[model samples]
Target: MFYKYKCGNEIIRVFVWNDDFHNEVSVEDTKTQKSYDRTIREDENGKFFTWNRNTIYLNDWIKISMKELKEKIENGERITSDDLCQAIMTDGVENVRFIAPLNIRCGFGFFLNGNEFKDTLCKVEERWNREIKQNYKIVLIPVESDDSVANSADYYTEDFVSLIKCGNIKIAETQKLIHQEQSNEDYFEGVNDYFDGTMGV
Candidate 1:
């Protein structure tokens, strides 16, 4: 399922509000459709004619479960950008998190040290709450590298968790590796850091 999120360069997902209405009732009571005669009326001035005169507002995020969202994507009925904006405004989140997977081939990726990135991210988080809605800019913090390694290694997950706890990052959703038809590119313009001074693998 495809969930609509506020995305940026390093920011994976954030919240956005949506203002839409849901049609839950039908007018003209018939055997085919259920009747809403017993439903409580808020604005009593209006009465049902063809459909239930009651207007239902959907202000919060339209969270279709993973199963549901995927079905809609398959069916080509998924939500749009407008829908996502409405959802965030309606949900009203004080703070949000963004996370990404990391693997090191040469130099560290996204943040060289914990403190530098942490401090930058803290500024971003604050600015997000004060200024931007869906246009926040994410700085790509370079990761620190260890020269002792010879081959590439998966990034440490503990550091990721620590960043989250310290409010420098957030975990959104786990990514699934899906193979699809696509062109392949093998562009190696630079040397891998892992092979800098180490012997043959």
Candidate 2:
């Protein structure tokens, strides 16, 4: 089963059912053309959208595709390419996770929303009420010069601070999460490694 959407001129197809486990395609707003903004526009047309492959309607105008892939992106899953446009648009830089450059040659950056990302402690909705509250984001570098995603990094090894460590307060990777419930301390422990930590400063 697929969840389809029509946003402005874009056509989004989501591989929903994991029964056959085809592709979760967790990324959103995928257009035939790569050029897309997360904000849904209501005034455009010329695209087609189908839901469950059962229902589809048409608006009018130009039916054009935006992306033609000549090659597949390596490790793009870590970049969260699906969420990049929206995250950048909303100033929610803290919501992105960095793994690598789109290409060492291409300055293009994408966001990877891994299966492990959403349920991670950093993005958890329960934070605002916690004592050491913070928004966590993952960076691949050694340290964040400041709090901005572009300059931030939280590199770590399993149960060890390999290089850079930044969070609400300082937390070591040695702490293990034993509590079935995620307490305040357990929250930080969840991000113990760079996989890792989301309890950002």
Candidate 3:
């Protein structure tokens, strides 16, 4: 089995089942089905995706990890994300502690830290379901990286507990997409709709 990550213009499909140690990474382009002989270290250096110590590489935006942000303050550098660039320095922080990430999927790879952050809750009302059946996607605030590393970081994993909100999977939205062959006509038909056809979904 493998997982797909939208990095830059490539839909990196990392095949995790390969036991061949000769090549640490067995990756391929999802569209062309072409494979590459590479190592995780190479990918970490932009052969694919960089394995960063503190920044997160998202498809739309880049985010800085909390530890990296704190170091920026100590070194005195401009921040990347605009969320709390000035707020943290002006308002100041106290009693900072890292919490295991609340979100499992696209939430965050870095551990969540709270200095003055507070949690807010909203009741699951019947009104939402009346209009749309899907659950709402919650927005989160991640620390910004300093200007120095902002250019480098473009933007991963796991477990523990939950004391905040609860959710159940919507089986309807969990459908798997099966690949279908498309002819030259069907492929070029939507050229006008997409410029380079490299845009990530």
Candidate 4:
């Protein structure tokens, strides 16, 4: 399975598990197409070790069953997109937390970090509510299957626009559409449309 994340200007695409012989985790920068590989390590004692303490903890969090994850979410713990991505890799999509549209098929994808994306969605929803004063449903579409690590911005924007269009999320008034070029400093704001919304599942 694979997951995508937008961290600053870098689009991080993580291949959790693949048919590759090494069974290593492959992380790729969508923009540069540069990649790195990390694998679970074992110490001399025959005990498995994660890349580091943080990753070991992350792996533990990933091991939490979906039921537990939901409970944690209900208990007010924020699940980072990184956590979700790792969980999806470890547990598979069907077993991961969050809701997906019934129409979403096997290959459909979601943002890597659920909490961060949700916060962004909330911002868009608030903007719409303030401007339009009408409730609107936001739907997230999977990144196009053919989206490449190189030129991730294209597919990411396409998916974002598709979500808006698919849900009929329109601006209440014609305002200057600010287009900010992606940069290492603040890519999230650059992609902000001020008209996005969140999906129920």
Candidate 5:
């Protein structure tokens, strides 16, 4: 199942349900008015995934679509590691098991102008912990870079040790950092300590 969103000045679309499926569409430019396409696909074990043909601009205001917003909720097109894993397995040819690593990248920055990249790993991890068996070691791969989404020249970097790998260390650290960064004060002492507790880092 997939959803289409055309909110505000941006015409965003999401084709989710099965890992080999994803497409994010937006206008090329506010001035020129061209059409651009951004698509991302991957597998269950996190071995094989790719994002192809997407455009990005340095401008400020991100155009969003109201139609797209309504559709995402209606279709349940949120990105998750399980979604990636299912995509890999569902799309695999024959019995050819994809024996590669997993890359869990949260594209938090705006690939489209108005779209904010929200992280969904915390929820996905909880589900995976309960549902996924112990025979398989699911490596968490995070695409860490400015252009990890539509800007990478290659298939994008997939690191095995992410916040998931280190338990919730990164999460706690991120929370403290966010508070400090936003408030402009070192109010939280032992922030790193809290993160360390999660992973013994």
Candidate 6:
């Protein structure tokens, strides 16, 4: 069976399959392409057993119902990214897994915009830094495809040492640093080359 639920501007698809021995479920966000899959097995006594269940994390909170979120949207309420973050924090949820954006490929782990909510941006930076400190080789990439977004590249720096010690630098600052040192016509290409050179790639 398959079901579709709308949450604000996003669509979530839920798929389920069952047999005499086991049941499988998959939930996917059409907007972000983030997904979770789970399976449950039936025992001899006809009781179901599962070691783990899939969950949807809105920020750090585990949101149990897409139906409720859809209802709120249908009722003409506006749900912003900040609202999602607030819900997660207030719900006292923990151990949430981070889902990378669909546009971001492997080797890069985070994408931040200059227009993001300040608190949400700070929280994400903190989480990424913590992962870095734990020896995760996560790279922060700042994207600027146009003049408006490119203007924000003024926030990131190329000082990797400072970035390691302080995780607050923006991707724009790094771009600015690269522009100053290199004469590449493509800003992103310059940034990519910088990292590649640093990594000896």
The candidate that wins on lDDT is 6
Backbone clashes for every candidate come to 19, 17, 2, 5, 17, 8
Candidate 2 Cα lDDT to native: 0.28
Encode model 3's per-residue lDDT on 1-201: one tens digit a residue. Answer: 234455655556544432335435455755667875444443343423342122222222233334455555446664322322222212222212222122222224344333322222111112322211111121222233222111110010001001211111110100011112244455676674477665453
Better of 1 and 3 by TM-score: 1
- Give me the runs in candidate 1 sitting further than 4 Å from their true place: 1-63, 82-105, 108-201
Ranking by TM-score: 4, 1, 3, 5, 6, 2
lDDT agreement with native, every candidate: 0.29, 0.28, 0.30, 0.34, 0.31, 0.35
Per-residue lDDT of candidate 4, residues 92-142 (tens digit): 432222222222212234423222221111112113222111212222222
- Candidate 2 at residue 132, lDDT? 11
Candidate 6, residues 29-128: lDDT per residue as tens digits? 5556876665544444443322123232222222433233335545666543233333323322231112222232222324545344221111123243
Question: Which ranges in model 4 have alpha carbons more than 4 Å from their true place?
Answer: 1-62, 94-98, 101-201
Q: Whole-model lDDT for model 5 versus the true structure?
A: 0.31
C-alpha lDDT of residue 199 in model 3: 42
Clashing pairs in 6: 153-172, 155-173, 156-170, 156-172, 156-173, 156-174, 157-173, 157-174
**Candidate 5 residue-wise lDDT, 1-201, digit = tens:** 223334444543333323323343333343445544444333443322122333322111223232232243246555333333333233221211211222223447443432433232211121243222221333322334334333221111122113223332122122333454766544343565576684355
Candidate 2 lDDT tens digits, 38-133: 211222443233333322333221121111110112223232222322222232333323222211211242343232121112221122222111
At residue 68, candidate 2 shows an lDDT of 12
Off by over 4 Å in 2: 1-92, 101-143, 146-201
Q: Report how far residue 155 has shifted in candidate 5, in Å.
A: 34
Q: Report the candidate with higher lDDT, 2 versus 4.
A: 4
